[model samples]
Target: MALTPFLVLGFCWLPYYKTSLVFKLCHSVSEAQQRKMGHSNVWNSHPKNYGPGSRTCRVCGNPHGLIRKYGIMCCRQCFRSNAKEIGFIKYR
Candidate 1:
């Protein structure tokens, strides 16, 4: 069968399609009802591109205490737990 742009290679919905569906649903509601739903619940929920909000730990998704040195994007807790495996030699 031929594949369309919307059709994912795997059985999963892409983020773009998911957010588009949400916007469509929100648009279907009345203006008053849409206003009551709040900005966060409807629009203005786009991903952060800059600033602290853009960076998050790869393992735990924590926004704070991230060790970004040497391209390590994990929080301190995750780093401590998997330090050895990550090639970090700790000296006692």
Candidate 2:
């Protein structure tokens, strides 16, 4: 009967102990191995010119374009007219 409480406590603590052991094992790995494992610093790949607000078209300045065609926010009319300039080769 006294062992019942101890068994309950051991079961509850088992997961926490295992988690700490796994973290310690990961931390013991060398930096070179971590790099080879593809662990990269996220900040290194961050955009240089990130900003708030939705991106707008460089030419017409419309926000609700059908799609970001040719990397610019442009409506259907503007996109068709400037498709060649924007680097999209028309089929017809």
Candidate 3:
């Protein structure tokens, strides 16, 4: 099946859809050919410098609820689990 522009664009945006026909077709092509076509790298072409995408948790790579305070750079869940090890003391 031939790929449409919408399919190619959608493939780039929704990369989690690994079962997509577009992804399957694209992977059939050699990496060099994919680079020449310029669609395979579209998903990662943009830099995530200043948003949730840029700030992933250091411990588990979770993007949500990231704790950037004190440069912890961990998600809230990981932080809570490892807080004592990292020198945090809970007080009542």
Q: Report how far residue 81 has shifted in candidate 3, in Å.
A: 0.7
Residue 64 shift from truth in candidate 3, angstroms: 0.5
Which has the greatest lDDT? 3
| lDDT tens digits, residue span 28-48, model 3 | 434455466787558688887
lDDT of 2 by residue, 1-92 (tens): 11211111222423334555454433333445545545455545655554323555666776555456455667677888988896889677
**Model 3: which residue pairs collide?**
none
Lowest-sum lDDT 10-residue window in model 2:
1-10
Shift of residue 11 alpha carbon in model 2, Å: 70
RMSD of each: 13.8, 13.7, 11.8
Could you tell me the C-alpha RMSD of candidate 2 in Å? 13.7
Off by over 4 Å in 2: 1-53
lDDT of model 2 at position 42: 53
lDDT per residue as tens, model 1, 1-92: 33323423234434435556454432233445435656647575788798888999999999999999999999999999999999999898
Overall lDDT per candidate, in order of appearance: 0.70, 0.52, 0.71
TM-score of each: 0.54, 0.32, 0.54
Candidate 1 regions with alpha-carbon error over 4 angstroms: 1-40
